[model samples]
Target chain A: MREVILKTTQLSKRYGNFTALDNADMTVYRGDIYGLIGRNGAGKTTVMKIVTGLTEQSSGEYEIFGKTGKAAENEKRKIGCLIENPAFFGNLTAYQNLRYYCYQKGITDLKQIEEALKLVQLSDVGNKKFRKFSLGMKQRLGIAFAVMDNPDLIILDEPINGLDPIGISELRDTFRRLNAERGITIVISSHILSELYAVATRFLIIDNGKVLKEVTKQELDLECSRCIVLKTNDTKRAATLIENKLNISDYKVIDSGEIRIYDESAKPDEIGRTLIQNDVTVSGIFESGVSLEDYFKQLVGEAQS
Target chain B: MINIIRSDFYRIFRGIAVYIAIGIMLLAIGVSIYMIQPGYIGNASVGDINNENFKTSNYDEVMSEYTLDELRAMSLSDYRQVMLKVTGYELDRDILGTNINLYYVFIFAAALAVTVDFSGSSIKNTLTSAISRRKYFLSKLIFVNLMCLIFLFANTYIMYFANIIFNTKQFSSDISEITKITVMQIPPVLALAAVLTGIAFITRKTAVFNTVAIPLIMVFQLILNIVAAALSVQEEYLHYELQLMLAKLANNPTESYMINAYLICGGIIVLFYTAGWLSFRKAEIK
Candidate 1:
């Protein structure tokens, strides 16, 4: 089994008359680019804050790196985070600010700061004061700070909120590269499902302070993949006919009455004729697919409604 | 915690606030070296100046005609003779005053160094990654007090030596007495540091800290004076005030009074430190 990097069980947070997070549960395994998809004020940042120790959970518990409570706190040194905003001393340069954190985190060498800035495409402006930075620059610096420590796990909240398209694409590649090359596990949150779908290996969708769904990349791909779905009870005969007559092998048999063909070469009319000729009742047949955005809205909209 | 402190200092030195604070202090020291005269002291000892003596017939005339600078420019014996004729007494415990005013500098510096983190939201970066809330609070508390003490001693000794070099031996008191008064001011100064740090955590805003810090001691003394006066007790309650304690400490306070002040300040330090930490322990960083 893969190592569990972060696991939250029934974690909740409340502020006075409002509930920010309610009995939310999530788990991220090592080397997984876990994407937390939620709309604004949907408890995505709340979960990140609680796990990163920016705020305490009102109830329930969470474990990081297989440890809970105080031990979990000690384990936090191996994690990096950028929650809510990129807060740094305005007067200090980006390099100076990261160097300060390097000291705080007990990092002896400073070259890592340069490499982090370079990864975020911020090396040219590393000497510029933070207050003088543009919003996109600030976001890049925040990302740099989160990755500079070479942490085991990274938790980022709306990290691409202000980046332009090119910056976003570059950072996406950076995250993917870090996860692939360095084996750094990351849990990134965003309301933009399309952007997240491009990078995340696993997903957790939350809305209205509750977790709505969790799905792996393969499951999401299968759900979202465009295909022709056929319903038939005679699974044995239908499979033989489809292979021999239709020459469509890119398919998955979901159950006794459903078989989905992923290859575009399998025409609906040909499959229907072939199945009917073989005395296999084709009860239902049509194209079926859903975009990631539609699916996220459906989940969040259902919760809101 | 030490790492946090190291980073904090790194940030501080790179900023302009600490240097500006030091500049203001040095300017105040320079101005204080010359502008402060017997007339500015306002101590009860000034009441001892007999108005009828020759060469000081008009008490205001001699002070206005010869500034302390001009008087000190004269030979030592000549300077002492003129001062004895004008005030009818020598320098007393008043000139070697407590460094209570230095506490204000520390407050402003603490506001910049420590409180700015909360106001600017940079605290999120630190607490979210570098350390736990407990260590954050501890490092800040220790940093504020340690920085305060360092500035406090450095300013006091600088002003102490400056006073001796420029004002002549007759005007400057003994080094041992000046050291005693400076040491005696510690409990109160450190107590103020803890209280300011507590206020920073509780309020978590620069404007609020400044609004409270700028007028803190004066307000405390004013309230004490009002209570003492309203109760028809001849201002007895004013003795516990921060400025009042400062004024008293410089004037050779009694041993029992020193002990009582130490105990009270000790209680204040503990109360504020624990209160600041507890208040900060669970604060939701937004």
Candidate 2:
């Protein structure tokens, strides 16, 4: 029964005839990693920006730390946000950029600059300019700047964008560390559903400027129950045999040697026998649980169609 | 507020603006020195008295006739009269181009300052850092004003020092006139900067807006000057006779005291900040 740090009621934003965010409702509880899942233009960034006061909503209301007002700016002091692309001084070094933000927040802890850089694992880039950093490094730097203040609520939009697997894993671990070690509530918006599931404790799926569902980790686990997985060397042949012989039509042959059947009852042994009898190479067979990617496609497809 | 100012100052001083401002000041001093040199004008001057094509023939006649001693004597005895006549004298029609321009450096510096925010994306980051839009805009305005002041002072002092070091020209001692002229120019510089800052706040792209704005502003200022001159109100109330007077009120003082300049600049800053705050507070920041 953690307290709610942020709550929005029917918050809407419009740009002329285009509604960017439509009567969206969300709540970020204390010590929670709330995942905001959406496509490129699904209004995730708009929601984060509105809550952070970087943008004004056309209608509806939001409360931050129990404070409700259009000009309730003081509550923002407890929140840190990195919206959209990482905005920073390009000519400044990572350290200098962090220091600039620290100064702006009136945080006199000079050691925070070093700590921020260290947290991002960019301590070696002491004097290198930000423009020279890779896209992954820039994304990490954006996160570092956001979290350096040690604010109670941290909101990140597209945090894993342009990040490699290693960098993505590193940031995921950092998010967990921040939440568990520091008791900071995190609200992250990202298109990477798998990574979001890896670090987030709750999910807020949005589409076409509206929230489709707000599910917790327990709900997501419940929804992501057993999914049929069939691995075979002859993926195309296996997929064709599964659709034609097994009559499980909706299936996807991913990568070089993997076929996934959405139906949980479609046993891999039956698929393996069908593949073997059909002259397809039966390399591996198993029943796997549903991954976040599968769950996301299911959720998004259900809404989209 | 102090934090915003400090951060803004660092952001500004670390960019290309430092080089540009220094470059402008150095170039101004270099040009002023060249212009004030004893024989530098000879390159453009002709010895022929009746040569109508010669741009500085009249000034050349005055200079060629007077020896160093005579010039020194005139400078010591009737410096004000000599300077007034020399400064007021119209150049030969051939040497005088179609237009005489002033405040190119000021416009350049102001435009650079206004565009820095867009080119760097620091404005967005700054506003999101627990600082209100109003305070952020104020800090930026203060940073711009400080940049302008530095350039203005640098240009003035560089010109003075360069003339003393390289050229043998006697620096004028007309403090009241110089002060009036300097004071009169400050308001418009501030206003021009404010206007450009507003445009940058609205457009949020330096390369595009500045490319279009620089020439457009030049033309607008030219037209405004002509219209103001034609209206004849400048001569009556506004001190269009000087640079700063164009943006100042009719009841403004002519002295070099910075209070009036500060007031005018402060008002313009408030207007710009208000506009910028409104625009930014509503902007999507996409």
Candidate 3:
């Protein structure tokens, strides 16, 4: 088994009468580009903040590299993060800002600063003050800071928010390269599912401060596989019929009285006919595949209901 | 912790505010030196030859009643010194020697040093680094105090240079005495800077710090004066108060009084620094 880089057990956070996170549990393993998926106010940033030590969890325990409480400071040193907007001194140049952190981290070699700048494609604009940089440049510089320390794990919250398409693509490549070449575990949260789909090795779906599901990329891919979706009065019976009569057991019963048959060889018309013959009231039947976005929405919708 | 301190120093020196503050302080010192003149005349009896305007006042006033002939007979340096004393430069000892504007300069420096982290949201980066919160807060406190000391020394140097350039008759006090008085001023000035730093950390806005700290210092001085007056405290004991200690150090340098000022100012620095650190450690970075 790969080592678990980060784990939180029943983490919770509250603000006065308002509860921001409720019994949230999450896990990230070594060398996994973990994607955190959630809508607005879904406790995504809260989780990242708590992990990065930016915010305190009201009640619960988190372990970084199996170290809990204060001992995690050492573990935290091996982790880097860019939570929310990238914070930097507007008066200092990009190189100066990164150099400041480098000194803080005790990395005396100036070459690392140059390397980080080059990695983020900020070498050319290293002398420009942060206040003068555009939003995209700021975001890229933030990435440079995160990766500069060569941390074992990098947690980014909406890291690509203001990037243009080209910038986003380049950052995606950067993430993939870091993960693959350095064997670094990455925890990233973004609303752009398709972009996330391109890089994430695993997905954690959250809603209302609760973890709805955690699935690996292979499992999610299988979940999103081409399949025939059938809405019937009784999905359990429909599933049984499809398994018994059609000799197909690869199917899942989703919420809203729907069954998705993953048997690629089985046609939707044949499945529909078989359901009807088995006295199953087939209200709707269609051939479709779930995108990550659709799957996230469905999971959240089910949790709400 | 050392690395964090180094980083803070880098950020501080690279920024223009600190340099600007130092420049303003130097300019203020230059202006004060150019404006001040020594008290030249000793206690001389002018009762026999004074005009009617001299009748209402004493010996100090008798010198002010000099006739045109007497004024013309006086040397240029003596004339300038008398004029300076008459214009209340005697009470302006603090302004001329101790760099009176340093109090405000410290206020500005402390606020700029601390609040820039907040306004830029750069504290998040620092806190998230390998350094602990305690170390970060300690570094800031040390940085503010160190900057205050540097400004104090700079002001003192300028004052010495000004004295050498303008006071051709030589200063009444020796270099060692001047150094002792200058050193005594540090504790109170540092204590004040620490308090302002605490306020800046709590408010995290330069404007807010200025608005709150200025009035608060004035009110504190007022309250101290009222209490001193009510208690019928001796003029010497009043030097033990916060702002008065600095002023007293400038006007009246005494070993016993310096000891008391040190004790009080040292206590205040400790109290304010502890409070500031606690608040900073507990504060939620948004």
Candidate 4:
């Protein structure tokens, strides 16, 4: 079994009458670039906060490096987090802010600060005050802070929020490098599914404070693979024809007029001919792959239903 | 814990607010020294002069009996004596009164120090580190007390040097007595700092803490005085108020009032610190 860097078992969080997170279970393994996918107010941040000790779970427990209760504090020191907005002293420069935290963390080697800034490509602007930094720079600085201590686990919530395309790509490369070279387990959440899809090895889909599904890169790739989309007047008949006639069981009837065939070997021409032969009026037939966004939507749709 | 304290001190010194507070304090001291001229002293002594029945007619006769040179020498000696009584270290009991308003500055400093972590959301970073909540709370408590003590000593020395420069008279109290008086004033200030810091941490907003804490301190002092009056405690023994206790301690350092002052202020510090720490430990950072 891979070393589990962090695990939450039936975790729940409630604020007053509102249940922010409900019976959520999550697992992040060492060296895994885990992507957390959710819509706004989907309890993504709540989970990250609980893991980082910014907030407490209402029920259940989470273990860091297989430690629970007070012992987890020591485990937390190995985790770096940037939940929500990156918080720092606006009056201090990026270097100063990082230095202050370094002091707090008792990191005497100042070289780490320089290296972190350099990694974020912020070495040139290290002396610029945080208040004067652009939104993109601030986000980069936040990432730098998270990765500065060379933490075993880095938990980032929407770390790419304000980055430009180039900045995002740079950060993506940085994330990949950290996970590949340094063996850092990264848990990142972002609405930009394309970017997340590029780096995440595993995906956790959550909706309404509950974990909808957990998918590995292989599973997600299979789900997002090129598939024949069949639109017929009778999707039930089309689905049956694709399954019985084409011997393709990996198919779903999305609606009365739509059927999605996930069989990579099933040809669109054959699928359309089979639907026609089955006396179903074929409207549209084409091959397409699911985007991460579409996959997330489907997961949430399933959870809601 | 040491790292937290060191970081807090670094942040405090780097920020502009602490310097602003210190500047305001020094300015207040400078203005007070400049305002305490001979004319004001003479006016202040008028009531005492009348109470003593030292008629103005006697001054005219004395002036006539002495030559101009003799009169000048005599007037200089009298001026020195009055200045000694008014501005000497022994006269420093009123130092607290002249600088009591500076308590607001100290309150601002304490509030800023405690609330910076929340205002900037830096506490999240600190909490996520290896430090525990208990250590953070203890570090803040130590930081506040250390700052209060430093300010107390700074104010005491400023008043001492100001007196020496302006009055040009020998101090009635020795350095040891003056040091004791200054040291006795610290407990109440530390108690006040504790309460303000507690309010800052509990509210986690400097504006709210200031708005609530300043009026709270004033009203608390008022209520204590009202209760003391209702109980018909002798005015001399009514060191229940912090200012009163500080003044009484400064004037009579060896008195029982000093012990009572320390006990009451020390108790307040403990209560506020405990509440602050508990609230901080449980506070959920967003």
Candidate 5:
């Protein structure tokens, strides 16, 4: 529904014999919180770097805001990014560091410097050198630098890598505010699928430098079909009864006592009655939906298979 | 380009390694001055021990026959020759007071600046900006040479003041000749800096790169100087051939036949730089 701000077609990056990214086709739409999810060394950073022009691709092409080559410079102005671990001059103050970055980006507004610091919640760092800032604070500063220009699109790579729970929660809230209020499209890469699930509107799952699939938030929501989690004295008996009576065999006993049934069409009451008749004493029964972590694991398993 | 240059300048100015090396150079120069200034005696002998009179004629004969350690036990004349050879030709107060030593400081700057950029992820970020590779390389070359020029002028000015303080009478030695010498020195110094920058970019690191480059550069200059000398070129021109040609052409350094040397050497530098950029542009920054 939203306009596409960035796109890549068969973009590939090769390091000698090894292909770090292979035919990665990705589209980042405007006003969409696009999550790039993958494991370590999954070519997430490579894709980010290539798209940002920090690196070159061996084959294929990428268009930024309908621009290519030197014209990409103009399109780059609309996108802000923090790819990989952000490095700063250790001796410079946080403010000084941001000022240097802004100067490089050709932004002249000193007022935005303050706003950047405030946006990252690093205002209280106050004259502290970059070396002294905590890892979380440094990560925040990187985010601040990325969004300082109020870019239309923001790309962050593991922006919450070093943050604590509270810091991460705060950053999550900040991202929400930025998306909801400013309508800035964000493309963030992270290995933390659960954290991504809370904020991402769309997802691109990558492994071995290839995009396996791209799914929307509504599709992802539909993925979490309602199911029953049963804790019974005998999981074997529960499984047998469900299979024979309800024609269900696709279920897994999480531990020794509980079993999760994946069929959405089966009624919970019918399953309860069948289990009782089969003499499988279910001590507890609760209906819940699948989580992002579960869906991610399934996707990963499917890809591997 | 300005931003990158400013960042490079800040890094160089703030580097402890740079200042430490500067301090060491100044200390060495001070020691040299203390050792040889007029009547100063470094050891049992007067500063006259290292004069050219003892070094060239007699020292060569003695050194060719006797091993180095054997000279330590020889007669005073032999010992004087040995010491003189080790100490090198007398410090020409005319040239010495010119702060010619500070020219090496630019060499140090060029090496450090280029080496540091190649050390980590810095170069990737620097070149990735919306600037031509040529402009990026040129800006660095310009800033480094300018810094070297400033240091050269400042150090020479101070050394001249020192000569005045020491009451050396060489300041008035053919003002035209002194100016020729001073102006002639700039080309070689600038050339050395440019060559080193190119070498650093090619090698891309200090430890192994310098190990290989330093010897190659020294050997190249020595061989080139010998060739130039054999061809009856002036000593100044020979040195210029080795050091200043690239920088001279880049900055339009001189108006003489030296400009020809500059153009030739500068062309080589451009060629090397183009190669370096192409290599770098294709380099995988993992």
Candidate 6:
């Protein structure tokens, strides 16, 4: 079984009468890029802030690495977060700023700073002051800080907000590299669906301080289609049987041997049985849900409605 | 806590503000000592005090007996006493070195070290992964007290040696006496630093912290003096306030006065530190 890196059950945060987070539940596993997808003020950043111990929860509880309370707080040292915008001393250079963080984090070896700078492609401009950096550069610096300590889990809120296309692509590669090579669990939040879609293995859709849905990448891919997509050895035979036996004519043969049956009433088990009885090899059969954007919008809109 | 202090040191040394503040402090010291040098009155240094009209009838008769050379040859402290008798100017060299102005330095140091972090959002990074709120607040208090004490003692000694070098032996206090005065002043100055630390934690914004800190002592003094005068309070009771006590304690305070100062200063330190920690412990790092 995959290691549960972080889990929150009914975690909440309230400011006065308005709740910033309302009984939110989230779970992350080791090596998983958990994307928190929500619009602005939807408690996406609030969860990240709370988990990192930058702020306290009003109620509920959370654990890091199976530890709770003070133990869980101690576990926070293994997690790095960049909440909201990149917070740094503007007057100090990138190297100097990281040095300040290094001291705070109690990092003794100075080489980690260099390694982080190189990982974010900021090694060359380490001497450049933070105030003079471009927005993209600032975002890169934030990512560098998150990964600097070689944390077991890194939480980034809107990590791709200010990046250019090339920068975003490079950052995706960095995220994948960190997870793939070092077994780091990444929890990143963003309002932009496509950006999270590019790197996240699992996603949690939140709206109005509530979690709408949670789905994995494969499940999300399935949810992107609106029909039962069936792959078989014999497409002609399968199509004939689907049309004649099921009387499903609103279907299209998408590929060489794959067919998309758009009928909502179409059952895959019956179709697979019929196709197998008719000498057609049923390789795969599943209901295709919808496009990623439409699926995300549907979830959020459904939650609100 | 050590790590936080180290990081603060790194940040402070890199910034130009600390250096500028120190320079201003030294300049203020020089000008202050220069103002109390006895030879200088306002902008011009009066070569002969005998030439000035003695407004007081009693000291005027006394001054009429001494020649200009004899008056000029008098020891600096004795001359100052004669000047005090004749001109009614209170000129005690030790008391003139520093007053409540040192509190401004303490406030600035506390603001730069503590308030700037919150205002710049840098405290989020520190508190998130590094240390607990308790340690953060404790480190700030310790560092501010240490830093302000350095400035305070620097003023005391620099004034001591500076007075001797410039104004000659007559105006100077004994080194041991100067040390006694400096030792007695620590509690009150530390209490002042503690108050600033508390303010920094509460305000949590550089602009707001400075706005409160800069005029705080003066405003506090004004309010107290106004209340005291309105009530027709006795002069000795005015010294009960730490701000006034700091100024008066340099003039060879009695044992009772020392005991009173220690009590008041200790209370201030406790009150402000408790308030500061209470504000910081549950404070959200926004």
Best by DockQ: 1
Number of the top TM-score candidate: 1
| Fraction of the native A-B contacts that model 2 recovers | 0.70
Q: Let me know the DockQ for model 2.
A: 0.42
lDDT (10s digit) by residue, model 4, range A215-257 = 8998888778887778778777677777778899987776787
Docking class of 6: medium
Lowest lDDT block of 10, candidate 6 chain B: B41-50
Instruction: Estimate how well candidate 4 is docked, as a DockQ score.
Output: 0.60
C-alpha root-mean-square deviation, each candidate: 5.4, 11.0, 6.2, 6.7, 9.5, 8.0
Clashing pairs in 1: none
Worst ten in a row by lDDT for model 5 chain A: A98-107
What tens-digit string does per-residue lDDT give for candidate 2 at A129-219?
A: 9999999899888888888878899889898889999998889999999999999999999888878888999999998898889999977
DockQ of 6: 0.55
Model 3: lDDT to the true structure = 0.77
lDDT of 6 by residue, B117-172 (tens): 89878777777784678888888888888888888777777766776675556446
> Model 4 Cα displacement at B141 (Å)?
0.9
Candidate 5 on B1-286: residue-level lDDT in tens? 6766676665666546668656745654454443333222112112222233334334455457777678556665445444454333223332333243453465567666666556644454444444445565777777767776666555444444454444343222333433454565565556555566666666777675567654565466567766776898764454344433322222223477566665655666666556656655555543
Count of backbone clashes, every candidate in sequence: 0, 2, 0, 0, 2, 5
Candidate 2 segments whose C-alpha is farther than 4 A from its true place:
A227-291, B37-114, B174-181, B225-278
Go through the candidates in order and give each one's DockQ: 0.65, 0.42, 0.57, 0.60, 0.18, 0.55
lDDT of 5 at B284: 51
Model 6 lDDT at residue A304:
74
Weakest 10 consecutive residues of candidate 6 chain A by summed lDDT: A218-227
lDDT of 1 by residue, B1-286 (tens): 8998898888899988888888866766665555333222222322232121223234465567787688768764565455544442113234334345566678766787678998999898888774878788888888998888887777767776776676656446667876777778888878888888988888788998889877776676566566667888754344555555666666657888888878888888899888888888888887
Error of 4 at B170 (Å): 3.5
Q: In candidate 5, which residue pairs clash?
A: B191-B243, B191-B244
Q: Which tens-of-lDDT digit does each residue in B150-213 have in candidate 3?
A: 8888777666666556653233245565576677677788888878888887787667877887
